[model samples]
Target: MAEAQREKVIRKIEQHLRKTSRQLIKIDTEEQALQYLSDSFRAKLYCDFVGVVFVEDDLFVPKTWSGNVNEVRDTFPLRVDHCSKQLLEHSLTDKEVGLAVDECQLFSLLKKAGVKTWFTVPIKDELHTFGFCMIGFLSYVPLLEMGKHFDEFGQDVAVAISMTRNREMQLKKIEGIEWITKNLSIDAPFEESIEEITTRAGKGTNAEFACIYLYNDYDNCFIYQPPSYGEMKAPKQVRIEHNYILKEHFPFLEKTGGNQMTIPISMDLKTIGVLHVERKRSGVFMDEDLQILRLLSNHIATILENARLYNNEKENRNRLHFLLEYQQALVKETVKHEGFDGIISMLGELFNESVVLFDRFMRPLTYTMDREEEVLIPQLRAEAEKARRKVNPHIVLTEYSQTFSIWPINSGGDLLGYLAVRMSGNELNDYDQIMIEMARNICSIQFIKQKLVLDATEQAKENFISKLLVENVENHESILQYANLFMWDLYNPHRVALLSITLRENELEGCNLLEQQAKKAVVWDYIKVFAVEKTKEILAAMFKEQYLFIVPAEKGVQEFWPQFYKDIQEAGKRSGIHCDILLGVGGKTDNLHDYYASSEQARQALNIVQSRFKEKGYAFFEELGSYTILHQIDNEKTTDLFLENQLGPLEKYSQGKNMDLIHTLRVYLQNNGNAKSTAEELFIHRSSLLYRLEKIESLLESDLSDAEVRFNLLMAFKLYDMRGKMS
Candidate 1:
């Protein structure tokens, strides 16, 4: 009976071993292997408790256990050195005996839980003890009764479990790594790569969650928030700066005790970021698990680096293409034909951003916006000006997902403006920077070219007008003929206003715009808009050199002359453009052929006024003694005497360097007896200019307030200017 019973036990043990072997082979992950050995085979194997304990560097840890596992796990510390030192020491020194505890203590503890006998077998690989497989017997069985057969059977099962678990772990690791490498080689986007890695890692390791953190060098931070989980509430950034993280709040590092594991992702001795995982069960990870995680970390780092490089290369290629297009457009002068708006739009499309072009004064000349303009124009102007003044090559501003990079456009050693490009959610990489530089260069060249063209055209027009004036064909008949020709030739508006010089001597023949000072003043005043309304009319007519016109009045000649004179005087005073005016009145005549006769009469009136008022002041045709006398002074003798008398004091004043007389005369004329404005112009105290004016009044020995005396002094100054020009 005893022998038959023993055979039955042997057959059952064989069946149990066969089933364990089959389950271990089918298991795909470490967690499955652990669960199979602990839960499915425990009771059938005559074990009160089944536990798999992994050993590393003489330390033992209970990875998974059955038979009131929760209670045991909660009661004991997970630390191998402190919790399982006795078992580890016994397993290391004595393989044959295995590790044993006092029957009283072990059996009593088991008996309380409906278990009476206990046995533990050391799990081994190549003669080294990695862990132990433990089983508890429900009925008390004497050691002698179990004998060598029972002990050997237990050892075989433990060894098989350990070997199978290790083999599967290594295979899963290789498969996981291979999958990541294959996916990354295709140059996947960051999000796609991350998703694939995390899913594979989670499934292979039996983890509940997986995450990757990437290093950001610019912000000096780490980004760990994953899209699958939405934005993580945990802080995504860890600043390397001091006082960032307190020691008390440091994250737990033990892999087995906590639900989390953090492994440094490294390549070539450099740590890039961290890979973190969390398991649902407590005390689940072992040393082998950590080894697998470290391997996975290496694979992740390689894949991340490759993805980054691929993105960089792609960006560089796109930027190069954009630069080529920009250069081509600029070289072909397409930018000029398209205008500022077109250029800005092209820039925006090339960079996938909104672009704005500013003028030399930092005013926005053209802008392309992808969205509505929410920011104030003044704010944009202010920011652009600040960037321009600093000459910053790139100024980056981040607000939400948008980033603005402002680049200065420099032309001919002068800052012309800026190019502002707005990028959404991404930083400006090296390729973007290179493209911006190319754009800046192109813009600078185009701007300079346009300015040069404009300047040359203006110069040529001035030269043409100067030639006509110097030929002494600027009278009414000749000017009208030129005006008619200009009206037919030009497309813009045209108007002709006669500007006659009221000389204080018989009229000078060679007086025209050809004189260098007058020509220079005309050009300067044209640029300064000194007489913008008048200049615009002339530019519309001829688009060239300055001119003087003489027009005959048809009616109201008496009333028109004074008003016209006042308008010219005020315009000159307002703009600081110094020029004398003379009006020519003639009887109404519709015949264009009679213009020459009217012009001659006007010249005769101008000559008479120039002689009589050469030292007194300018005179009108109505103020002249008679038309006969005015016509008589067109002789050379009258002009010679007028010049000598009017220019005598100026000659003496110039030779003696007596600015007192010149200043007194200038103030006397400017003040027009007000006394205040003249003093301000001379930068002297008002009382001083007044005293000097009084001295001039005494020297002249005339009532300065008298219209005749004042007129004489003013004419003398005018004659002095005319005589100096002649000399």
Candidate 2:
């Protein structure tokens, strides 16, 4: 080459390099720097094509190009074989090397574009070569002398490009961090914030996709949180271990051969989750990408922690407010004396659930939310028993295709009943629990108040009834006036019933005096309920442990008495109460003043059941044929004198013995002197009865063949049986 031409080429190259340096000084991004580099080289150097190839996965990938290379642009990326390897080696050693179509296969694309030769210059920093800047020529040009001058210029170009790339990368890191920080400052929802963080991290790291997986503490796993923006597909859940890799947890991802970076989102030294980014065929992430992701992960952790705390506080506040409102509503209801019905109505309305009020016996008394028939008393009682046995105050029973949350109503440790809230599902949130608890407490107070009123009213009724039945009060006008106050029209004749109840030992066992008394009250409640159902209209009162019911003298009374007894038995069994019931039905009275006579008849009949009529649960006063006659002879002294005269010696002799001569003689006479019949009735052999008969005759000093003697003995035995049962 001539000296003047060389000087002109050198000056033109120098001028273009100076202008490129000035253009890059104003550039703030890497894309603009690379585009200007290609354009400046192609236009200023008069080259047909200028392409910037970056090292990607050990291949030279053309990232940007200028001028005429569109025909072969799709196949521009070339693998680093021996030919391209030689060119890279020379470029990295600070040599600008030229390539011909025959010299290297990488130059074949330029040849196809009508270029004869192409040469490469390395873009590098002090320690590493990032890529090569390739210039292609369409015509043959001598490059031996030009290559020397361009080599020195290539060093300056490399420095400028490397500096521009680094500056742009730093600016992007700042912008990404600032963008995430600004979004975090906004009061967006937790999910929205998470989406923003993932988006920024993906963009900042230049990754193809990004996503987050939140650590589930309860499940001890990581759950995928799908961002609204991202193309990454991840598993819904993963059982993560310490130092986990995405491909290890999800093996299907391994086939993609992509680069994955997982950064732990941490708060207070605890890893809450992971921020993950993936690079498909784009290649691996750089160290700067990792640093930027770490900062984003930290911010995400902060947002998550804040959201957790905020949501918890908001929930607590809402719960407290709800409880206060519920308590206020209950207090108002109580003040108005609306009782159980109102309380359940409020609960049903507020919770949109069914509510039932049960009596202490677990019987459904009132219900709200149209759930009257659904409240099964038998199931409720069973659940209540379980709760009591388990020492749990509340229990949930799921049966009959429904669920119920039962809160026991107790006052002073005495369980009143239960407030049952029928649940839509089996789970109860803390708010539901709080509301139910408050309802239980309110019901307990109402129960105590109702008990106080009931006790006072019950005491008055008992006093009036006791005067009529036991004291035989004779003030007719005054008695009628008092009866009217109890809604009883005693002007009509009425029959009296006496009840003797013996509770099973287990029901009262391990109970204190008050507890035992409470149990008795519950039994009384059950008896009252059944009695009213049978009689339709009755005036009843409880005294000591017995109940006295006064019903109209209707023909159904006969059936009512028997069925009432049977009903009590069945209910007791179903309600888990084991007991014995002895009932006595008295004859109808003529008037209110004659009620005392009927009551006395009922007493005598009940007495008969306790002693002689042991096989039957109830007895009628009019049905006691012999006992009625004996009881009608009210002169106790005369009956006693006759009893002593007839069988005093026999009774004195049989006092401590298992055999009773008086009973044996009575059975013998009552059976019409047929000893065989008497023996069969007594469950003994005839010889045993004959011997007892001989013994009784010997003791009484009378012959067995006298009808007068036998009659007198029968009378004495009847008195003896009646007297024994009465005592």
Candidate 3:
């Protein structure tokens, strides 16, 4: 049996290498060659089964002949993973065939098949093991000399596997390069295309992980896109200072310990990105893999650079086309209502980018972006405010990224507001700047038209209010008709509130007129709120130096009046406007005639508020319980004569002697004849105050206890204080 087996082994080696070598060369694919060898060697080697494994990838995938694939593959104990320790021990020393039953699980499998011996011949060259072939026999004799004799057959199989694997590797590398370079679309999603290239490169080079790190001119750093099988969220970005061509450490590799290889991806021999691949488990590597990786990196870099250039050319073409179309549309579209609405819409449609239009007050007239729904109101408001503060009328591009460019819009030397162009990629170039400048020029016409319409409407509103306040009430129907024409709710009960703001002379000292105005108006916030109030439902206007608010008198609105007054007065204080404020609230009046009456009374109450109270800045006509009677007497002669008849002698005496009699008499009357309270009020001694009071009585020639005299003297003191400033 030994002699027969020796002869059979010799014959099989000669036939497999010499005769089948020509057939193996004809095989075009690795799978065909593997299957052909496994099936042909089973019967010739006198074995129950045969299996072939080749190292073309990170795995030793076995091609089995003659049984269930899993059952056959599961029995092998010399697989790359199962025999890795033993293989390393024999990496250079042991390369012969083996039939050790105690060392392999295949022994049990062979026993079940009634086989007594099993042989596994490693297919390897001097440098590395390409693959191995395994065979099991029933009742074959164990020969010590056959181990060395099988070396010839093993060498033959190793040569075949090496040729197939090398051919496959070259073809795969070429295909990978071509796929990435020629197949990817210029309009494809840039990040997604990059990820696909990384995945293909990993597969081509037998790497467990792969990544593409591209240069970001905006951040001045490298951004990593990790492999799909890796930590998906990992390496979204990293700040790598050095270029990939130089030896720089990747911070992402610190946590993921592995044997890694990185190649600089270049376009026209200039590195712009990096290609990184790693083996996580055992760092399976080869010279062929590194060579293929280098090729892939070059291909990926060229693809990216070409795609970027193509996209830029396409974008420029689109922009030029849209500019011409927009100019045509702008010239054709006439103003319907709020003439700027159409222009803003055109701006959004043409740009296909983030475009926001703000008025001079930093209030958004209209806005649109790439993803408009994702934008927050505060972000728009903040960006608009920033654009509003820039003094330059040309486009101002921010540093680092070209995503945002702010252009101030002006016409006839008056700044209207700003046009902000924002996007996601490269900064605004000269073409973008020129396009925006033209956009601004075309848009200014609408701005002027809107302004003209606004001015006409404002003039009409002022005319209506002036006529309502000053015209004769005999033609009240004509006045109501005119109010209805301006969309004013004249049928409802309306009351007017006047907010008078005045600045002291010195408050405007260190500031220019424009700066002073800006300070007084609170710049952005106050102007925004005031513009809103004027344009929306509230009927407000800037008349003289006061703000006029004509509003509906709804129920429970009176509760807000106190806080509203405090808010405006606090605004004045904060603005350094030293404002003297007097708010006279009119009573509710139903008819047009009574509306005129209410306004007249409101004016009268405002005129008398200073004379009635000392420190009160506000007065309500309904709450003026005793002062209502005082507000009725408007004749200056009556007031002058009353003051003269009552306190003329005391005034003369006080001026002549510089005594406290007049003051004491006034305090006593205010105190209702209580000397203690009167002295406390005057901050004097009670006995001295009483002496002054008696002296005053002796001069007036009247009893100190007369109720009629007390009443007349109190009225005289109030008139005396309001002598000159009364209106």
Ranked by lDDT, top first: 2, 3, 1
lDDT tens digits, residues 1-727, model 1?
9789887877776677667766765666666777787786576765566777676444456778787635443443334534434443333211222343232232233335554555555554455465665565556654324434434544554556666667776786777667666775636667877777666656555677777777667776667747432224446666655443322222644255455666777777776777766753434656565767777788778777776688878877876886887778765654446356666677777776677777654567778774565353456666555665564444444333345667778875556567777755345667667778877876777677666776675555544444433324344544455556445222222112323443222223455635534533443434233343443333411223323333333324456445555654564444334445443333332344343343344444455445444443234444444453434444556655554554444445446564565545656575787777777778779888767766555555666678886776665554433233323
- Measured by TM-score, how close is model 2 to the native structure? 0.69
lDDT of 3 by residue, 510-593 (tens): 878777666555522342254335435457655444456665677234575666566556545533355455566666657665
Question: Candidate 2's residue-wise lDDT over 1-727, tens digit each?
Answer: 5888888877877777677767776786667888888988887778788888777777778778897667756675667662456454444211233334455566655556676666777665466666777787767766544554455555666666667667876876677668876777435777788778877877776777788888888787888887634675667688865745645664433132337777778788777788878764366766667777777777678778888888878879987997798889888898787467888788778778777788776777777755454546567667766674454444555555666677778888777887777777767788778777788888887888888887787888887776676545666666666777777777677888888766678876887887766665666677776656566577778855567878788747466666767876665554456667777778898865577788878888887787667567888888888878887788987887888878887778888999987677777787899988999989998898989988888877898789898778777766775675222
lDDT of each: 0.55, 0.72, 0.63
Instruction: Flag the better candidate by TM-score, 2 or 3.
Output: 2
User: Which 10 successive residues of model 2 have the least lDDT summed?
Assistant: 90-99
- Candidate 1 TM-score over all chains jointly: 0.51
Q: How many residue pairs collide in each prediction?
A: 5, 0, 1
TM per candidate comes to: 0.51, 0.69, 0.46
Window of ten residues with lowest summed lDDT in model 3: 88-97
Output the lDDT of residue 264, model 3.
Answer: 73
